[model samples]
Target chain A: MYGMISTWRMAYEGVVNQFERLKEGEFAGNVLEASIREIEDFENFISVGYGGLPNEEGKLQLDAAYMNGSTFEIGAVAGMEDIKNPISVARLLSQDRFNIFRVGDGAKKFAESEGFLSENLLTDYSKNKWEERLKKVENEELTPYDGHDTVGTVVLDKDKNIVSGTSSSGLFMKKKGRIGDSPLPGSGFYADSDIGGATATGLGEDLMKGILSYEVVRRMGMGLSPMDAAQTSLKDFEEKLERKYGKVGAMSLVCMNNKGEWGIATNVDFTFVVATNEQEPTIYTSKRTEDGETVIEKAAAEWVEEYLSNVLTRQE
Target chain B: MYGMISTWRMAYEGVVNQFERLKEGEFAGNVLEASIREIEDFENFISVGYGGLPNEEGKLQLDAAYMNGSTFEIGAVAGMEDIKNPISVARLLSQDRFNIFRVGDGAKKFAESEGFLSENLLTDYSKNKWEERLKKVENEELTPYDGHDTVGTVVLDKDKNIVSGTSSSGLFMKKKGRIGDSPLPGSGFYADSDIGGATATGLGEDLMKGILSYEVVRRMGMGLSPMDAAQTSLKDFEEKLERKYGKVGAMSLVCMNNKGEWGIATNVDFTFVVATNEQEPTIYTSKRTEDGETVIEKAAAEWVEEYLSNVLTRQE
Candidate 1:
């Protein structure tokens, strides 16, 4: 089943709205790139692309990754700045005959040579957000949350091929030169003909601690449903972290099999968007049972509205 | 069933020699720490510790990671310099009560506060290595080999716990702030009480593209022997890369199940060491048959002699 999904609803909406382009026979890669372009341009999400938060040094160092599943080719950049759409730059790097990966200034130079326009990604809103935190920090500051959230989209194309892309400004006030799972190939997302596709959002430090996405995908390969794979991996992730920090550790994942079956899993109750050929885009909220099982429920719009602005902000 | 293994013979020898200390009932953590202390001080293995390779700027930047299997805790540092024993520093970060991760100056500051001594890790040999690469640049340097080889050791202790540590200088002449699988918990290594333990070497870029170590460990959980897990991962790694580059990519792995059954796999032909209670220290060579299957052979002393200085020097 051909479909697309993202960590944020707006991001998924931006892509699914472009589903008309697929009807017009546009390339899958172009749709994937255009999707993140929407998130990069969206002002509401403060965790990815332009207007996203900055590092401790007050610089918006971005990391972006894109993978072409049929070809098993990948492109990524870490600490790249100035480019408006890093996912496209990542695509350029992967498609270019000369290189598959570049970093920092070299990546920027490569993007420029490939005709990507350079611009400062920081916007007034993000600047204010960072400034507010700094002001909140008195002579002594409280430990802030790992506020890094990424824009990840996994699409299973008409041919059942999966392509995925991820972009992030990374942890709020994360260390300078810090590169998270966003730009890493397997840690952030993965897909194959043998398995399906999977992507993650949350504490990358925690997600990167285990197979995360691939664990779910390979479990799918082992005949577990996408939801079961995701739940199993999350169970392990929780057990791994709960020992030290009680119930702390943030991560949520979505999985899609080539058969067009998709399942969702998350440690906390949160909603993600789903788009497919037979249905309008809908939201699913994943909740954990008291017995430590994952449950997926269709989220009411009113509940989603409250969850996004209120519940998510508290998490940040 | 409790044991430790490393890439370098000298490193493994250091830990196995401490069998007496185990008999005297020393903590496994202390024994694991002491094992890596030898590698940290060894002058050979230019990819690790002091005198290792430098970044493009001619400054030595190091990456190290440590994991406690029993607690499922992980600590890592990337691009840290002026530290002789980054593996131990990683251990300190994991053991600390207040912090789980710190990077760049914050990590350096924390290390200093934790009483870690700072000194230039670059050695004359490493300095010359960087200079030579720059001088050898012709018109423009070609895409160099992956060139990243790390020091990873997995220890299974008396209580059947696993603790692993990886330390590296990353790729020869890599980007100034580039971080690789060495510091990533899953991409480079992963362990679970049910799944067993695994670690990797060579070309982190390739290994991180898949859930290399975790894939191996998960296969072990599925009833595959440690050797089968390693072989399956390496095969998939080769198939994935071969499709794109036609016989390009580099990686090696070691896997040890909770049962103390262990195996080694690599894309390139090389030998690694192993030692346990029932066996003397043995060097095993991984040779591929004409059908491209990996088979282990007892490496002769004479063949090992030429392979090390000849093959390893060429790889460097």
Candidate 2:
């Protein structure tokens, strides 16, 4: 999805609407949880949200991370299984430090203490344990793990402050022990309300090694347009991984100058949608491939108009 | 395969070798045709010189382009189906006008005038057309048309001269009336002995639209390594396609200075080997997936070495 930022008036309006039906404190929790849950539920083949391909081992092991650039607050988890919604946990952890939750057995214990069902399993593996198991199973028939591509958002408020969140299982069908860019601090998720906010999706290991976030931030600082900078970074990644070809794919969306502009670029052909208060959700893909010839400009115009309309309607 | 230069010595040696086996001036036509036939039989993946893939309509269409940078000579053809060996025809065309061989029905007449087999069908589509009524009645479906991917070669000889050639049937299962990058001057194959050379692989339409070959050449002029420039140009193709997370596999081999130093990059994890008189055939791929973790160094080393050894041994 394209970068999203609701103006102060837009967010305040949502808050006002929520206050009419619920208590003030409940609104923040509801909206955040709702947004995060949506991340968990995203199931499109193109988008990098939840329920995507498994790890190389073929099992669903979820991981996620998020950061509120405004407060310089962050949250993340590496190996969470039996958790239906990981983005929720990440959001909780990024909340007030007093309310920040720890993961692992303690996290499960806390969830149970709060009456959320927590499964009991003796064989759950931490990142370290998973690494050891990977060595042992190097020559064996290893099961694939879940590493769904990530879906994330960075919202710029009217004051131009920003909050960004990321959610993913990781690469689909990854190895049992593999950890992708998702849980890494700056690699998987980072945002700054002052200038702009960005989110990335693709091969996590490469992204982590490249320190991609810093590069994106650096480019943004140099005053390149969001689209040009994002596309340029993606091109760099392509050059680095040329010999591996299709083994990697990535997409990122960025909002700059308080949502005066935004950008989305990806390696493969797929759809990305953007929604804002002033526009209708607009969907964009390179060009729809039905029989083969690319319909280039037709698809672009449809997306731009639809997106603008969606944003306009949301203003009410 | 990365860029290669069959030295002027190698070409002369091959021609002389063929000449030695023939009686002086007795069958000069047969000798030259047989020599060209050698390259026609080199490889078979539907993308190589002869018998390439057909278009979606099951019609056989072929495109070929060749340039000898040393001589500043070039030849190209498109939508010709009856030519038995297009490369040979192209080579003849590039030589003195007296060497030009008539093709299609005219070629058959010329062959008969020269007492060679004049009735052999050059394309399956041509054979099918003769039996059109019977073909429609036949319940069995014929193999569907799959247009060829562009196959190209660039050679720098001992004289520091360059030669490049490309041939393709077009895209696999493509729409009718589609032409590929093979016949394009810069998109498919290009070489300049003073600078460098490159050949492209993947969907020709995407490459042409992106002006990939020109981009690579321009980047090389800016001091980027030949391999890096090729990869950067390919990345431009990917972004143009909006492939956020899919493979658009391609490979390009490039050489810089005449020190024979070269670089190769591909989107797939396949070994590309090359042989040199100074070094054994070397094989290389940038990354390999092993037990879930991708190993970059080992993949590159082994592939380069193996391929180089093979190519060198074959040359010997």
TM-scores for candidates 1 onward, in order: 0.86, 0.37
Model 2 in CAPRI terms: which quality?
incorrect
DockQ of each: 0.26, 0.01
lDDT of 1: 0.72
Cα lDDT for residue B79, model 1? 66
Which stretches of candidate 2 lie above 4 Å from their native place?
Answer: A1-33, A39-58, A96-116, A119-147, A241-257, A287-316, B1-316
Q: List the residue pairs that clash in candidate 1.
A: B3-B156
Tens-digit lDDT track for model 2 on B165-216? Answer: 6656565443333345555445565554445555555555334433355446
lDDT of 2 at B249: 34
Name the best candidate (by TM-score).
1
Model 1 lDDT per residue over A126-197, tens place = 787787776665444654555767888777777667777888877887755556667766678877755678
